[model samples]
Target: MRVRYLGPPAQAPDPLDGRYVFEAGREYVVLELHAESDGSTLLRIEPSRGSLAGLYNSRYFEQVSDVIPSLWGVVTLPGGGVLLGPPKWLSGEFWELMMEREPEAEAEFEAVRDEITAEDPVARSS
Candidate 1:
């Protein structure tokens, strides 16, 4: 139930990790479910980013029942808001999937980091 922010400055900031700018001129806020242990679920909000554009470009939100425990449906609010919670059947499915995929996901994430660093000279210098 704990919410964590993810995204660039001016949109989501402070005490949050995992924030990133997916593309220019567009921003998103990613929140993670911290209560889970095996893996975790994410809830993203794209306030001011518009609905159709945000939904198409944003990667922080998805309906992946196989990876999120008990996740059923998401509620979309006005102004590009969203809420994610578990359903009945998929409540524990996420944990199992996360446990199975954590290592691979971590490796993939690290590889992405390395690739980004190699591509961005500024990042490589830092």
Candidate 2:
């Protein structure tokens, strides 16, 4: 997942070119996951761009799933925060929370992204 720094909600940014970019923000991350009634873990993942403006448009934002493989269920944010679950399963409220960037751990988050890109072919292709 490439880090895209969006400007504002009113304007769109350049096309992601198949890159999955989530908004940079500090949302309530689930430090741990619990088993659901079906025995599968149900985790909340808020993978939104830093802001609406940071993304080119809603269509592009929706396409985020294309870059992320459904089999993988963990996202490590630049700040070392973890987003657990599939992007499509994420709630709208979660996406909204991504509007603000968590500046405190920006460096860490970026580093993590870089590491993921180097290690994961799915992320790199996206």
Candidate 3:
């Protein structure tokens, strides 16, 4: 999957520090935060459309969920899985950081949205 930067670029946390799984279409994206001894949070992601109610059935998901807090975010199809991180505040913050990293890309996305709306005159009226 292409990783599109929707916000400012920020350094990605260490890979060893967290778990990340992104299943764009099949299910919800899962994030696991592992707090380090140094007071740092490790993050991990898992993509699944299935219900979290039975998440424990999956050893992988269970293991991660068991260790750290899990965050959930919905994703629209054809788009990449949403980045869900622990502590609700980080969600918006990270998105902002990502968008800041790619100002031009964000502009292009807006342009595309405008173009689509313009082409659909009926949409404009509604």
Tell me how far the alpha carbon of residue 93 in candidate 1 is from the true structure, in angstroms, after superposition. 11
In terms of TM-score, the best-performing candidate is 2
What are the TM-scores, per candidate, against the unseen true structure?
0.24, 0.26, 0.21
- In candidate 2, position 120 carries an lDDT of 41
Better of 1 and 3 by lDDT: 1
Q: Mark the regions of model 2 whose C-alpha exceeds 4 Å error after superposition.
A: 1-38, 42-100
In the range 9-115, model 3's lDDT, one tens digit per residue, is 24564333222333322222233233344444333332232212111112122221122122333332233233323333243454354346556544543443344
Q: Residue 14, candidate 1: how far off, in angstroms?
A: 6.3
Off by over 4 Å in 1: 1-14, 17-101
Runs in model 3 lying further than 4 Å from the true structure = 1-101
Tens digit per residue, CA lDDT, model 2, 1-126: 222323234545444322344443322122123243343333222244232322232222221222333333655445444444434323244334434544534443344334433444444455
Task: Give the winner by TM-score: 1 or 2.
Answer: 2
How far residue 44's Cα lies from its native spot in candidate 2, in Å, is 6.6
RMSD of 2: 12.6
Q: Residue-wise lDDT of candidate 1 within 1-126, one digit each (tens)?
A: 111222345555422233442433332332222223323333333233222111122233333222332322555445454445333212445434434656654354344333433443333345
